[model samples]
Target: MSIAVITGASSGMGEEFARRLIAEKDGFPGAPFDEIWLIARSEEKLTSLSEELDPKRCRVVPLDLTSADGIARLSSLLSEKAPQVGLLINSAGMGKAGAFASQSLKDVESTVTLNCTALSEVTHVVLPYMTSYGDTLPKKNGPRIINIASSAGFLPQPDFALYAATKSFVITLSRALNQEVKPHNVTVTCVCPGPCDTNFIKVSKNDPNATFTGFKAKFVTTVDKLIPASLRAAKKGRSMLVFGFGQKMLHLASKILPTNLILFFERNMK
Candidate 1:
């Protein structure tokens, strides 16, 4: 069976991606996804989403990817079934906004594990199962991978130091992995979306009053706007996608702006 595996599918962009895939299957010609493996930490939310989707096509795997056992479980399943991976969305991540010095060791470690380690492990395990190889160069086809990196990945953010650094790793991995998998006809896209109207703020434990301030406030993207744009960019086999015109301009700025100058401005903003 062919399948699309999405992490962080309980809420936010991951959940929206699942919904859009089912709704837009006809939009993608030759889409062969007969099943969707929804992986998330929340069993309740996963159960609810499964009920909403086609029961026969949706399989909920409620496991915390940060845990070694959870990662092993998914790896075993993939090895056993060896399903054709049509798409893989590495959207599972966590962050907390605060001074790095003041953060708990647990919180810092969790952020690094979930945002970077787990994502890398999942992608590595799934690559062998993707049905992207062919006799000819595959154009606009899967298996495809989308890693949900943050706009913060582009620059240093003082209050969000750990999160920003982890996302940077994600962006780098996505770009490099794209080249590595290209010969196999696989496409990897890194999505850099700004703040969105999602529960991420709460999940990240951002201070309510200071959550979206300064330039970040102006470029807050909605799930409705962000997911489709990301999906479209990935389908086109783009290496990186920064959502919204404002965010796009920001990405460009990161490339042109001097490192010290950008750091100075971000430090003042925080």
Candidate 2:
């Protein structure tokens, strides 16, 4: 059986991907799959989402990838199913917005665990189940992995230091893994988007009223725009996708400008 495995599938970009894949509403050609696996910590949310979509086609797997047990459970499920995973979107992540030292030990560790460690673990577990190029599956239907990174990863941020660093790890890992998997006909696309109007902000800042403003606010995007574009990029087998024009420029600036200069500007941007 062919399946699409989406982590963080209960909400935000992950939820959007599941909806688009099921509805096929986005202009991008949707991949055919016998099942779409919705994975997240909230079983209730996942079940609700599965019912909202076609439950028969959606399998809800509630998993807290930050913990070892969660990863083990996922691995066991994949082994038992042994399905040909046609698509894997690792959208599970967390971030804490504050000075590095001000953050609690738990928060700091959780961010790293979810955003970096879990992502890497989940990807490796799923790779074995992904369809290979020579598996008689049509090339157009070849397996694809979309990893949700951040434009913040292009450079360091003063207040959001750890989040940016972890995302940098994501960008580097995805790029290198793409090269390794290219020969197998499995493409890995890293999506680096700027700020978005999602639950992410509230959760990161630990405040419902928290949001981007002034210069930073201009770059905020919606999943409605980001997810579809990312899917298209994945279909085309692009290695990296910087979602917005502004974010693209930012990505370029990180490459051309000196790091100290960029950090200076970022520090004074407020």
Clashing pairs in 1: none
Q: Quick one: best TM-score, which candidate?
A: 2
The 10-residue segment with the lowest total lDDT in model 1: 131-140
Poorly placed runs, candidate 2 (over 4 Å): 25-30, 131-135, 138-141
- For model 1, the stretches where C-alpha displacement exceeds 4 angstroms are 26-32, 131-140, 206-211
**Per-model TM against the reference:** 0.93, 0.95
The clash count of every prediction, one per candidate, is 0, 0
Question: Candidate 1 residues 171-247, lDDT tens each?
Answer: 99989988988877788889998899787887676555445656777777789988989889978878988888877
